[model samples]
Target chain A: MNKLMMPIRGDFVAPRFDLATEILIVQYNNGTLLGEPKTIIMDRASDEGLCQMIVEEHITSLVCNGIEELHYNFLLWKKVNVLDGIIGNWQTALEKILDGTLQQGAVLYPDEREASSYESK
Target chain B: MFTPDIKSLLEGIPCPAMILDHIFRIIDMNRLMEAMCGHVTDEVRGIHSELVLRSNVGNSRDRLFKSVMETGEPVSTEGDILNCYRRKIPVHYHISPLSNSENVRSGLLVVAEVLHVEEIKKEQSNKSFSSAGIIGYSPKMQQVFNKIPLISQTDASALITGETGTGKDKIAEIIHNHSPRARFPFIKINCGALPADLLESELFGHTKGAFTGATRNKAGMFKLADRGTLFLTEIGDMPLQLQVKLLSVLDDKRFYPIGGEQIISVDVRIIAATHRSLREQVKKKMFREDLFYRLNVLYIHLPPLRERDVDIRYLLDHFLNKFMTGLGRNIAGFTSEAMETLLGYKYPGNVRELSNIIEYAVNMCKKKKVGLEHLPGYIFEPVADSPVAAGDDEINHINHQTSQPQERPPSLVVLPEKTPESWSDIERQMIIDTLKKHNSSRKLAASDLEWTRMKLWRKMKKYGLLP
Candidate 1:
């Protein structure tokens, strides 16, 4: 069984990996879902605590939004598959990820056009 | 929670601005900020505000936007906006609450203006602090460096707060060094270091016969630091009664001698620092609220070393170079695995802890490159359930010792009945044999046994290996 974790905020991928106060853990066995998804709400934002959770739970893969290069490289060194820079609704991101349709910097929100559009000052 | 197209509205602001959530996550940043920081808006959104604004004054509990978000008010402060090229553009920023159409709070909107305040940023005084060897290029530290120039020109009572090893004293010295009063004496006293009477006498001069030891009139830190700066450290540890006197001194620039009727006056710039939160101290009545307000004119917060994750590698190399030559060791560098361990370790003691670890490694390393064997094992034991393995030798030994049928039924393998004493004797013999095998090198023996140096030393002492 491959365990996957994703740091989350409200309904989207947490903007910053270290400051994520909520997370989701999903277990899969050979592309089959193992059980119900679990959400762990941390009492506070702690990068070290999050990393500890990943190791303790034996999570093999992670999906996050913005992570500093130091942590990104550290997780990679630990052999965790990191799909980084992904934005939008975290549930959709997870759905796309389980099917191997997730891109490195995909914006998966329903209103992707508005989220991407910006007016310069 | 923001309104529809809040990012577009934020980008329409005339100057550099950003929208941050309650946790200070970058909800969005405008084009000017993107241009200044050289981070793509799409890629940068959701990062911590510190990564983008690089505000030197913000900590976990003490940020301008945080205060605004909490109190539902706006705050305007002077800060240095750090750019991608390591350039600091002195800026004045205003952080206000971003509310939804229903008047419900959502996030914060921060607007900044580039300041032409070149006079304050001038290379003012040449005098250096007695302790001025602060070195870090982390965005937070760079913000701190930028703040010194801005705050030094003023005589505001700057409150420096952080964990114990965050160099609060050094920052106070930096402020004094860059200030106009750099030529005068910079007196510092830790309120918690001395008894109440002595602390009072130290802050305010005492007359002859004031106490049993008062044989002559003694000048206090306020008197000694005349026309200079007086750094009051651990102000939170100061007694409540003394807090009133300290507040009066800050209020009038004068204080009465401990035993004399005469009120002694002095010209001094105040710079106080504490590791504890003055606000919390006030709520608990351990620190006076009025006194905290007096000292909180300009606040500077130092983030813990672990939060400055990018700087860990740089600091490791910097400290290694610093301690290696001094320790008379030619340790080249840390191996990648060792560096990874250091990077992953959340240094609770902050920068000072890291320096000690580096120095210890430098002193212990026998090879050109410092490996896992040179580093302590306990640094990696805090977060994991797996015991820290020094190397493959330790792993092999642990595997050997643990593969003795304990996991299976007792009938699986024939074993002799042994008392605890006999087991200790066997363990002792094993340690001695391992030591002999490694040429009496305790470090290697400890590695082979999968124990910390201290733990191995205790076992060695129990076995009478040390005279």
Candidate 2:
């Protein structure tokens, strides 16, 4: 079984890790989810507090967007598999992560062609 | 919530434009808005406007966005917004209430004007507090930086006093570079490096046979610096006999070469520096009072690095970036624990020592981040327990085993079940083992450790291994 955490804003991944206050945690065995995903809302946004929670919860993986190198390195040192720079709906991102198809810098928005066009330029 | 007519209206706008529903969710955005926000229209459609805009002004609950929707009035303000990549961009935005054909308010229209975002980012990145290559932001350093230009315009003899490695020589060069005499030569002589007679001969020219070893006539530093600046470093170490000659030359702008009769006149600006207090030296009758008065006309003193509050962090990052580029290392930064250890250390050697420590750490770091193990062993040594007198500039010699009584307890040290082997112990053992393997040859040992001979020699001396 693996536990994954994603900092979220509404339906999408939060644009910045440090600014995120809402988190979604879920546990899965193989390709099947064991139970309902849990939502946790912090009183305020703090990268350090979030890191402490991640460690205490024993989260095996983290998916987020726009994380600073300091916290990223800290999480890496903690042995958490970090998939950063993800965008769009958290549900689709979670699905992709479960199937092992999601990669870092994945933009799951419906307008993939438009996002790619801007990125290329 | 966005009507086709409203979407078309947004597309007609010249600048970046978007429409938000009554709930503050983004309804639709024009192509220009998509480019500015680094997101496509479909990506952000129906999302909360705050999630997409990320304005510095609090959220949709803030007065700017809420007041516009509630009162049906337009609000124009200047602030910052985060793009899709989380980069803050300065902008001026106007939010106005949008109404249907029946005159019923449905949503709000927002138009943005980016205010030189790229230029503002560039300015912020380049806004380090520094002057003439000297990096310091403390009030004391700022006062010193402010005085450099004013003193540079004058020809008066200037005196600079600071602890060793506080960049006294760099300050002198900056003054000379900014002076009117910058076009001519800038010469420097260490007053403490030579003996009394040799120092005298170095200051004033000497004819052939001036001394037993003088086989040829040579120009002195004063002659070499004619019409320019002559920096006299470690001026307090100059012998008393030589001080009188320096005073005479400062007053008359003329001096005779040794073994020569005619006095040679030269126009030169004098900048003197010393780590010791000239006033204390005068009280002890070691330095001449008359010469001290002459050199103290324009004075500047640099505070030690430990006294600088925020500058330590700034210099750490500065030197880290510096050495990273020079060494071609991809090291990102120091770990949190390493940063804490570095910040807690009292740098007795001032800025120069901090720079050297960073260089050594960067060289030693193998991973992306510099860990506590990568730092030099000396930094972990405990500071002295003696209390420092307020306003005193002296540095107390650090005692490795003692704890500071007056200051807060050191952050990293605590009573433990078992004290781990300190980096100092590890380093000493490594040096000893390496030396034995190299057959006690310093050169071979240094090479094996990938350190310079001078570095190895200094380390050996620090460890009391010097025979």
Candidate 2: segments with Cα more than 4 A from true spot: A1-121, B1-131, B385-467
In candidate 1, what are the lDDT values of residues B22-112, reduced to their tens digit? 6666777888777656667777665555535544444422455567877888878775644443334567777788776666565654545
Error of 2 at B250 (Å): 0.4
Q: Pick the candidate with the highest lDDT.
A: 2
- Candidate 2, fnat value? 0.06
TM-score of every prediction relative to native: 0.44, 0.47
TM-score of chain A of each: 0.87, 0.90
- DockQ in order: 0.01, 0.04
True contacts kept of each: 0.00, 0.06
